[model samples]
Target chain A: MSGVEFVPLSLTPLLIGVFSAVACALPGNFLLLRRQALIGDAISHVVLPGIVVAFLVTGVVTAWPTMIGAALASLVAVVMIEAVRRLGRIEPGAAMGLTFTAMFAGGVLLLEQSDTSGVHLDVEHALYGNLEALIWLDAVGWESLLDPVALAGLPDELLRIALTLVAVGVFLWVCWRPLKLSTFDEAFAQTLGMRTSWIGLALVVVAAIAAVAAFDAVGSIIVIAMFICPPAAARLMTNRLEIQITWSVVFAVLSAVLGYILAGYGPLWLGLDNAVSAAGMIATVSGLILAACALWAPCRMRSGAPAQ
Target chain B: MTVELISDQGIAPDARHPEESPLAIRGMTVSYGQKPVVFSVDMTVQEGSMTAIIGPNGAGKSTLLKAALGIVTPLAGQAKVFGKPLRSQRHRIAYVPQRASVDWDFPTRVIDVVLMGLYRELGLLRRVRKTHLDKATSCLERVGMADFADRQIGQLSGGQQQRVFLARALAQGADLYLLDEPFAGVDAATEKAIIAVLKGLRADGKTVVAVHHDLATVHEYFDRVFLINTRKVAEGSVAEAFTPDALDRAYGGRLATAQMDRAAS
Candidate 1:
């Protein structure tokens, strides 16, 4: 189980981290524009019950059922929030707060009430992802990637993140104009026959898919951070939509790489003898980047050179 | 109650082009909750002319424009453009909502906002081609903000922003242009520039409908006027409908001051 192949071993965590961060950040831009950053948090909380229920119903832990279940749960969460807002005559923020809490608690209760076996789904995993344990055990260098055994040993989480990132990229590519117009000016977009409410719904659903796909490998905390910080920081740096998207992806990848390296090596370099949580550190890095942008982004700030 | 005036010079609408009347509202009743805002309003705007919708504050001046654009849901009646529904004819219509209706601080350049005018024609899944970008650039040049094409919208002054919006509507290339309060807080120069643009549109044979506030410029700027106070008070040429009696009826003693008549004169 042990080999001195340091390259492929470390590459696993970094690749997985970058893919997951990029996936979350891509859709995070729209959530930021639409002011639905909190909805990302809500879906992360709600997807847990979906996974556990999928596990119980199928008696197996696979990607397909969990994806469907999580997607459904997020939709249910949105409808429930709307209903609570309308029926209770409360504001939208209050409705989201009330709905997510109740659904999250319900998810926890559902997990406990079910007697599922052979599934690793749990609350702690949902909160803090199992990032450290995903190292490729088939130990090999880059050349060994062509080996069947090495290919098989590649963490399935990496493949999952890869597919999710691709989906995010393609959807944004196809729907760029409509999405941009709707976000900037909904009423005018409608006057142009965009069917804005429906487009708005599609945006939410796509964002939900990204959140849910990320949940299994990276958990909710990092997903939630990646969903808000990178795009926000990019916003501080650019005014164009396409450029903002690129900058956000770049920032997200930086957060993932920097966070993973520091979390793994910073403690050892300080003689603490153990790695820290990569997920928490990544979130912290994104926050630091955002804070830095707000203070010194030259496009808007007077005291610095522009970050462009 | 609905009011309809047969203008002596009003060209009879083309039958085959029943939808060709630029804008026609019939029995439009708009209410917010239990309170009625616009009640059974009926009016028709002739093509190739500038028409003003005038009313006191809270008189539903803006609401009528919104309902006609289907931006606001109407409690009763329908709005048509060029003898067809607003939905089917959306592409032929260009809307310039109030300048304050959007977040000026949004992270988009002046050119991108103008480019939005081309989105309908570009449709989904199509990139903005080089030809379209050239068109958008020309639109910006027309508004005299070509130098600020890359500038963020927030950097512009109020008058500059209004001109940018006019530039966007100009890029829309629609036959009917609907503007809501374009001159609400503009400078005198900006007002002159806007009127010049409107005149240009009229000269090009495009129809324009604006929600106007100042009574002074009504005579100079508009060929026709619709005076209302939750109802259509009168509709005719400025010389015909801008009467002291009709002004009194709509304003109800609010225009008892001498300046009111002086502004009209």
Candidate 2:
């Protein structure tokens, strides 16, 4: 176990999971705050066309254009939602449903128009992830830590993940009061001279960036699970905004690690030929955790309550 | 001007010009989609007066207030506050929306809500300091909620929640306040407390416009009333605006049989 040859095969997925948890949790807390959980679903699906278009134009998969294209696509999604709001006077959820379905359909059309190979759209790799295979890539590297037993290797995407998480965390920390008030009572927020539109736009931007980061790691399907489930679970446990955010981060990180380990060992343990995808497994666990948390929260609240 | 008009009906005080008007809306129209909710309405809220915009449901009372706050775009007319456009005079106005409009489950405290009232004054990118926090505490204290400053807003009762909103508005320290149905669903104690706070605002020479539904309480609560039914029916002292004629016009056939004794008295 001390030698490099004895390094855990689950290390790569575990790292990916940890990073995904932290990245999604920050914006997930905000999305939960705004009651715009569906926006995560919208951004995840909408980014497909952006990535596809970028690939078609650039003839290569680069991070800059991919992220930018995804951001633009997310903006388009917001505009579409606003247009539906203005024209149809429909509820926001309905608008989100209409826009995402159309954008996702457009993405499918783009993929068809480009005639990308059957292997190109690889749902298996995209939805579930191929973390074990990625450990050999140019970006993932191992760093020697102070402790000989505990070695920390920095991956290529680590900086982006770390910086995004830190920046978002600090941004929310600084704007916590405004965000809290704005999310709670937008009308009152407006009266306070806070620019509601700008705050709304900032939230959208945060959602888009978080979605983009998760897009490359686990693809669209898992991003929603990471973005919504943890915060929702956190919401059940706490009423304080700061505590909820903190709990969400903790839950996400735990789910990621648990999901990664489960996916790695399930094949050997259960005699399954194809183990579940790491992202799918993590998302499933998160959903289960949220459901369990929801069911038990009321009981706990009742038990703790004094005689009224 | 000194003579009171009296007929077989009753004595009517001469409608003297108010010392000042804080808000005025002229020929205002608001539409949702193609259909109009407020049509060619004209209203004026006097300075230092607690005015209530009253009508039955869907009478566009809230819409009129939104127009005054510049929250809703008017299709035809303009709303001026303190002799200036609402956007330019944003700092002078404070708003308290109905408590139902916000998610109580949101993770925020009473103090946090109150501090937000100072955001416009504090400007963007500037961190909130001890002074802002102190102001928030004082505002909460004014609402008699300073003890619950650290309590989550969700944990409070409906009346307490309403008081938190009032505290947030009070923290704004604005010259004008537009509250949308602040008394609805509130307990009697909370209602009296709110009225006291409104009177305090009036005493400070500020203007208040509330969208109210309780016909029984309107006269007792407001000095001025704007009777609205898509369009302005009348605007004057509560005694003048709460007449049988205005009630008939505002409520149509409904007011003929369904009379609250308070409306007549």
Give the top-scoring candidate (TM-score): 1
Give per-residue CA lDDT, model 1, range B31-52, as digits (tens): 9878899999998887777999
TM-score of each: 0.90, 0.85
Q: Give the chain A TM-score for each candidate.
A: 0.90, 0.87
Per-residue error at A41 for model 2, in Å?
Answer: 1.7
Write down the C-alpha DockQ for each prediction.
0.41, 0.32
Fraction of true contacts kept, per model? 0.46, 0.43
| Model 2 ranges with Cα > 4 A deviation | A1-13, A118-120, A136-155, A269-275, A298-308, B1-20, B121-134, B256-265
User: In terms of lDDT, which candidate is strongest?
Assistant: 1
- Positional deviation of residue B258's Cα in model 1 after best superposition, in angstroms: 14
Using DockQ, give the best candidate's number.
1
RMSD of candidate 1 to the truth, in angstroms, is 4.7
